[model samples]
Target: MTIVAEPQFHVLAVDDSIIDRKLIERLLKTSSFQVTTVDSGSKALEFLGLVEQEEEEQQQQQTSSTSGLSSYHQEIEVNLVITDYCMPGMTGYDLLKKIKESSSLKNIPVIIMSSENAPSRISRCLEEGADEFLLKPVKLSDMKKLRPHILKGKCKDQQKQHQKITCSIDITAAPSPTLVAGSASKRKSMEDDTLAPQRTRARFSSETLTVII
Candidate 1:
């Protein structure tokens, strides 16, 4: 019997309210994902090992580190980031922007949740690279939407890897010898079919009548 391994997706849930954090954690775990909850955006960044400096130099300097989060908020390998829009320190929108800008963590899918459904806030988050925006009190049904974004991120990563591998190989190696031979054989067969049959002498036309003037 082949035992299939289930993928474990880790989620970082950020909210200022402990109750909300608990609720989101329960929702995510119910959907079969590993969950990590944080009380504030600053703590969330700390867990991710990100430096929270608002300067360009600080951001660049932090991202230079090989191992953990930097000033640019380089993301860890967490599959998803789901955060409340309203937070005490760094807002979800801020975290979303930092994650989107970081080269290492930009591919991870991000979701923003807000108690108030402001169209402008939703639009801004979407424009800044938030994959989905959920209203406050996210339901179990919202879990379904999360999977698609995660799958899309995984597919994109796969495509990038495949592209890199393809580019490193020789383009001349694309046409195999067997494929070329088969193509040539097919062309030859087509030529044979289009050619007209050779003209033959009229059957039994041996008696030729010559007109004498």
Candidate 2:
């Protein structure tokens, strides 16, 4: 039997410098990410929106072709976004803010790569919710550090979705003679138990536990 590897994750890279954009694109391609490079922030935004629309249309076509069942195949998966902070018309900050505000695009992780190493600039990017920041002349080793965090975030999101499905199953799988007999009470108790913290410890919990143990 022949096994095929899954499609690589996509990353949209935006930068004004031709050399910088090409460098980032090459780096991402070698690292297993399918990179799409755009010269300016405005072009990046246009490409993003266009790609989303095309995906939706493709999904609709696929559904109609079958018995209205949604297809599992993904044409493109844009899981991460990397952009330079200094662009002409729309700066990286502006693009980041736009992405954060859009409901459809807000969940995509964004990394700000820039040469501006000033404290204020870096602080502002963090404050505006950039997931990762890299100084200009990015190193391959530095890019590797961000992979774990990005993967962790993806795992957490999957876990949350699984939890929701499990809760729904539990609620619907009530085994009782009476239709309404233990359902509501069981749900309430479950809700409370779910909300309760798993552990309780003092302020210096780790240190105290280490010393006592």
Q: Model 1: per-residue lDDT, tens digit, 38-101?
A: 8887777666655545544555555643332453344445778899999877899998988887
66-144 per-residue lDDT for model 2 (tens digits): 1122335333556677999988899999899877765455667889998978889888988888988899997654555
State model 2's lDDT: 0.60
The deviation in Å at residue 119 for candidate 2 is 0.8
Q: In lDDT terms, which candidate is top?
A: 1
Clashes of each: 2, 0
Candidate 1 error regions (>4 Å): 1-4, 52-76, 163-213
RMSD of each: 23.0, 15.9
lDDT (Cα atoms) of all candidates against the true structure: 0.65, 0.60
